[model samples]
Target: MATVEVDQDLCVGDQICASMEPEIYEMRDDGLAYVVDGMEEIDDDDLIAAAKDAADACPVDAIIVEE
Candidate 1:
């Protein structure tokens, strides 16, 4: 499984992660990116890949994925 996290301090609210993976990420009213509830740890390969992609797409590299 992969553990995913979004660092609010590093997030620039670009929403790239949210755009790339809406099921796992969202941009809140605070202008920061966050991982949706219950999606912190991912076991599905497809979702893991999507999360990795979202992490890579983050301009500020706020997203972290640990396998």
Candidate 2:
């Protein structure tokens, strides 16, 4: 499984990660991007790739993906 995280402290509410990977990242009511619950461990390769892409697209580099 792949491990994913979003550091809210560094998040700028860009929503890039959410737009890029809705299944892995979401824009919370607080305006910061967050890793979807139960998504800390992703088993699908497509989802993992999406998570990595989202991490790369984050303007503030708030998303983290470790596979």
**Which of the numbered candidates is closest to the native, going by highest TM-score?**
1
Q: Cα deviation in Å at residue 9, candidate 1?
A: 0.4
Least accurate 10 contiguous residues by lDDT in model 2: 55-64
Model 1 lDDT at residue 11: 89
All candidates: TM-score: 0.96, 0.92
Candidate 1 residue-wise lDDT at 3 = 100
Model 2: per-residue lDDT, tens digit, 1-67? 8899999999999888888778778888999988889999999999988888888787888878887
Per-residue lDDT of model 1, residues 1-67, tens digit only = 9999999999888888998899999988898888999999999999999999988888888899999
Runs in model 1 deviating more than 4 A are: none
